[model samples]
Target: MPSDVRALLARHLPGREARSLVPVGQGLDNVAYEIDGELIVRCAREPDPEATRAEVAVLAAVAPISPLPVPEVVFSDPSAGVIAYRRLPGRPLHRHPVADPRRLAEPLGAFLGALHAVPPASLGELVPLDRYPLADLREEAAQEYEAVAAHVPPEHRRLVEDFLAADPPADPLAESPEEAAAGTAGARLCHNDLGAEHLLADPGTGTLTGVIDWTDAALTDPARDFARLYRDLGPEVYELTLAHYDGRLDDAATGRVRFLARCALVEDLAHGLGPGPRHYADAALAHLVRTFTG
Candidate 1:
C-alpha cells in the first residue's frame, strides 16, 4: 500500500488497526485494497468526488431491492476518495472457468434478470441517461478509432470506420411507436458492466454468489446489460440469458442490444489500447463487421 493510502485509511477507518494491506486488482478508474481480514477499500483515482459518492448511494439504494448479493457500503468519504465494503467470499466467474458454458450462462442470466427487475423509480437521484447516452458513446468511439487507427491493421480499420459511417438504424431496433411504449413502460436500474470478471461464482457448484463493482451502474436502456453476454459469451449464452430474462425482446430492444454491443467494442478499442489492444480491437471490429454485413 502507498503511504498516502495508509494515511487515508487511517483517517477514514479511525481506530481500526490495519495490520496488513495488499493491492488488489481494480477496473479502469478505481484502485482496490484488501485491508486487515474483514474490510475491502476502493479508492478512486479520478478527481471527481461525485463518482465515489454516486457508487455508495447506488449500492445503498439497490441493496434491498436486488436479489443477488451486492456489497454493503460500510464507509464512504468523498473528500478522501475512499469507499469501504464488507468483503464477501467467492471468486470472479472468470477465475473458475467452466468447461460447460451452459453452467455459467444459466446463473449469469438469472442474476442479470434479477438485477434488471429493480425499478428505476426506486433509485432516487443516481446517474441519469445523459451521462451515458448513445450519441455520446458513438462520438467517443469515433475519437478512439482515430487515435488507434495507426495501430490497427488497415483491413480492420476500414471495417470499423465503415461501420461507424453507416448511420445506426433509425428504426433498426423496434418501431418508433413500440420503443416509445417500452420507454414509458418504465426503465430499470441496470448494471451496465455485467462481465465475467465482475461476477463471483462458487468454485464447487458454479453458483453465482455475488455481483461486485457498481461503478458503471446507470438508469438507461436495460438492453445494455445483454451487450456483455453477446460480447463475452457469444450467441448461445446470449440466447440463454435473454430467455432467462423472461421478457420479450421486441425489435427495438434487439436493435438497442446490437447498437450497445457495437458501442462497447468501440469503447474498448478507444480506452483499452495497450498490450491487450490487439485482441479487444480485433474482436470489436469482427463483431461490428459480422453484425452489419450479415
Candidate 2:
C-alpha cells in the first residue's frame, strides 16, 4: 500500500517524490503516513471512491473558511481511497502536554466557532448526519466500562459507576425527552470525533496548530465537539472556549456538553487500558483524576 501510495503521489503530484514513508497513525477506518515530514497521506481501510471524493470536496470547502489550519489537499485519488495533504505543524496535545492548557482556549474557541458557523445546508448533502443516540452512547459506554473495569483505579470506580447509572442530559434542541433520547436534534456540522489526539499544538507556545482527522466530520449536536475539550482539558478551558465562540449555547446545551464529556471519558479510559497508544491511557487516567478532584 505504501508503494501504491508513493506511486499515486508521484503520478498526481509529479516531482514531489517521497524520500521517507513512515506510518504515523492508524484508526479503525484509515491508516495515515507522513511523507518526508512534509505531507500526510491517508487511505481508507474500506475503499469507497465516492466517500473519498466527498471528503476531498469537504476539505476544499473548509480550508478557506476555518480560522485555524485545516488539511490542504495536494493530491487525491478517489478510486484508490487515498488522499495526500500538506502536513500541518505541531505535536498532538495528548502526547505533548502544554504548560498551560488554558492557552488552547481562545484559538480552539475561535476555530470551532468558524467551523460551526459554516452553513450546514452548504455541505448538507456531502457530509452525513450523525445523530448519535444518547441511549446508545450510554449503553456503549457502560459496556466499555465493564470490559475495562478491573484496570480502573479504585479511587475512581465509584464516580465511574455513578455516571453510568445516571441518565444523560436532555438534548437542548429536541422538543421532548423521547426526541432527545432518540437523538433527533443534531443541528450543526461538527467534528464529531474531536479529541486530544487529533488536536495539534506547539508544546512550548500552547498554540493550537491544527485540528486533524475530519473523517468523522458530520452534521451532529454542536455540543458534541465541545464535549471533547471538556473531557480532555477540563472545565476552565471548556468555559473559556465558550467565551470566545461567536455562537451561543444556552445552559441546556452546556449540560449536554458535560454529559457527553463524561460518557466520552469512559471510552477514553477503556481505550487507554486496551490496545491504543500508552499516551491515550495516560491522558485518560490523568483526566479522570483532574475531573473529579480539581
Instruction: Please name the candidate that would achieve the greatest TM-score relative to the true structure.
Output: 2
Q: Give the TM-score of candidate 1.
A: 0.79
Error of 2 at 19 (Å): 1.4
- lDDT by residue for model 2 (59-119), tens: 8888898888888988888888888899999988777879999989999888888888887
Tens-digit lDDT track of model 1 for 93-159: 5456455666766666666667676655566578554235556667777887778778666666676
**How high is the CA lDDT of each candidate model?**
0.68, 0.82
TM-scores of the models, in the order given? 0.79, 0.91
lDDT, model 1, position 236: 69
Flag clash pairs in model 1.
173-251, 173-252, 174-251, 174-252
Q: In candidate 2, which residue pairs clash?
A: none
